[model samples]
Target: MPASRPNLRTIAEHLGLSVTTVSRALKDGPEVKPGTVAKVKAAAEQIGYQPDARGVMLRTGKTMQVCSILYSPEVGDYGDPGFLAQVESLAQGLEADRYSLVVLAQTSNKDPLEPVIRVHTQRMADAVVFSRTTSQDSRAKYCLQHDFPFVSFGRTELLTPHAFVDHDDEQAAYDAVKRLIADGHRKIGMIDPPENLTFFGYRKQGARRAMTEAGLDPESLIWMRSDVSVRAARDATTALFRTQRDATAIVCASQMTMIGALEALMELNMDTIRDGIGVVGFGGMPFRMLSKQKLAYYYQPQRHVGEVLARHLHDLMVGVPAQELQTLLPYRRIDDLAAFREGEDF
Candidate 1:
């Protein structure tokens, strides 16, 4: 025969306390005194008692958990360090609010939305957080259609109202390009991510806007789009330089792309930031390892983005009527052009 499992009633009877008190103590309810909680925990530990998560969830209408869905099209690797840091910070924030976090990675082979569907259908999580949103994002639309509690790390161009936390990529890109112009770089090049991604599109738009403001022809700027891989970036960089007018400065949308562009520059024996070819990249990179002279980039507050998203989701879960759509964060330039021109180390 299978061994019988311990329940709250059995634990209460063994401790000579009411089942309600036992349940509250186990739930870490504020009403339960610390002394009583200690005693109840001791009794539970003695009997090797474990709370039935499903039963508690059914009673409370909450799983006390949240999930983050990672939509990575590539295979082999699971996630990036920046992404992991965001998840870690978000998990810590949720834990402080008396909640749990579950990470779900979506591969190309599996249905990208399957994990979200399972969690919502099974009532396994109180809310969900979606990252890497694209224009006309079906995932965001689906969540809204079903009335699922969810927030996005990136904003979509779709009209559907949803809560999201994202960096001001447009402004960031504009600032980056403007700084290059201020540094006496006339021929500016831009390496952007795919156009389908709303986030990347905004960044590209910002670059163009800044160029137009500087009295430079928008069409004169060299623009290339590629994946986040080093190989893709290298190919794009090769194509970018093949243009009739070579760029004196290059603005990259991401650190990964910046690295590839640098490799291509080195291969071509072009002294970065020295051959009158300056480079400015958005997002943080390992500046410590790279030559300081060649490194001038923006720093993104990825962890802060996670924290704000988590707080907003918490409020939504607690019945707060947050804005149907909100932009809660701003992006700032990390390095100043004046400072860079002075050869100042930062």
Candidate 2:
């Protein structure tokens, strides 16, 4: 009868049953009689009574909710396409499994793990998924120490076991670089992410390994490191060109950065995949039509990552041990340039 959202107490009062009986019946507890369960279910449906997530967590030590903490300072500005896609996918997947998601954005100066700690302490979330991990990340460590159910979207350099869903960045970068080498391009350059981020470092390592396998001098390869920002990527691209005018190809770590690099290349009047410069970027962008036709790049299923993560969290919540510590999602290359020339619909 109240205007506010219905809770267990309200439902119990309407159904002429104790709150405990109502709660157990709603959860289908064996102690609750089948008739009582039916009555409670029907009453809940009639009044739209939803269990308080925090109260359920307090009573059962499980929150049917997951928090995704975004640590990138430029999360709003740079707008990681993969991250956004994953969030959307994860939300949908969780909803299908009767769970909810909360997004927490952490800025540069803030401790990324603080939100997770607060949520856990307040019994607001059952689990957390962290993105953009670093080597010896304090957030991961904190989660481990607190025995919180958490997973990462990226891997750390640590030896300890932690749940994660990530793409094989090292192998992907290696494969990308090898593709360029096979295309008769030598003196390749890379616009890598900062070393502080383990994923970026792994990508760099893969690129170097690929160069070595191709019998190219690693030292001769131009490499620049910067934050995962458009300006940073643009600056790195400009710097690479300034230092090595003969460099014929550029590898980028992200689509956003690649856009900036492409703009820089256009400004310098360098021919892409024609006169001299060839561009290859990692991941797909929301505004993919802007990319030049036939650009070589690896594309990760951003939405699939989120879907897998949500499934994993659901398994954990349902008393299943999530055994897979790190699940690597699959990726593919868009090799056809002309097919994308007229801007194919996504």
Candidate 3:
């Protein structure tokens, strides 16, 4: 006969605990002590015990799955090393706790609400996580109305508080502009994220505020809304220099955008250091290979962002209050930008 698979009873017997106690400990019931919970989990792992998820769902209304709302790749996130790192870390964190992550991909940004709604209506996941929030996100409202657990990777304009872990994009933008201005680049311009994103305005506001604080005309701070692609940024940069010859600097939304801007300058036969132009943008360590002119750039801890988002969603799943989970982390700045040189890893 085939060997029997280890179940709750197998774990309970191995730990000398009652089946009821073992189950409660595995579920992390409030009544169970943390020590007991840890013991039960360890015993289960050792015994190779697996719960029938269908039965658990029927009894506890828990899906053992979380959902992530994925946006279009063309909207700037395509081939983003930082973004890929963030998602990878987030998945690893959840998998560590036996909770599976289900990514719901969207075809367009025109309807950001559809996937969230589908997850809710179909009981596809216990909680959801999403990014690129707008000023007033209807998806947040829907999740709020249903009391479904969720953690947004970005903030919204909603008056009602919710769980979120967001980077301080405004502060990062402000700092980037201040650095560029300090470098003596007076005529500053930007290629920004899509206008619909709330952070786009936050970044714009920060840039304007920085200029204002420096006694510069905020209104004259040139702005270009791009589709978050290298080609779009290159085209935008070309146009910017064509019209505004006095422009001395460019702040981009992402490393890809900055790369395009650099390409534009290259095509124009203008060197960043030679032409007295400054470049500032946001990205991860991967950008070290592409950096130039020792310019300042903001770096987000993508792995940390993912891990925190995963933890927050798990907290929400375990009945933690949403308001208490809100976090705003400032992006770190690399004061000098230099590309990898001479036989270094690309």
Per-model CA lDDT versus the true structure: 0.74, 0.78, 0.83
Better of 1 and 3 by TM-score: 3
**Model 1: per-residue lDDT, tens digit, 194-235?**
677788888878888988999988777777877765567777
Instruction: List the candidate 1 regions with Cα displacement exceeding 4 Å.
Output: 1-16, 25-51, 73-79, 108-115, 122-124, 284-287, 324-327, 336-346
Query: Model 3, clash count?
Result: 0
- The predicted structure with the larger lDDT, 1 or 3, is 3
Itemize residue pairs with steric clashes in candidate 2: 294-337
Best by lDDT: 3
Give per-residue CA lDDT, model 3, range 225-342, as digits (tens): 8866788889999999999989989998887787788889888888777778888878754465453454666877688889999889778777788899999988777655453334
lDDT pick, better of 1 and 2? 2
Off by over 4 Å in 2: 1-4, 7-22, 30-47, 61-63, 122-124, 284-287, 337-346
TM-score of each: 0.81, 0.85, 0.88
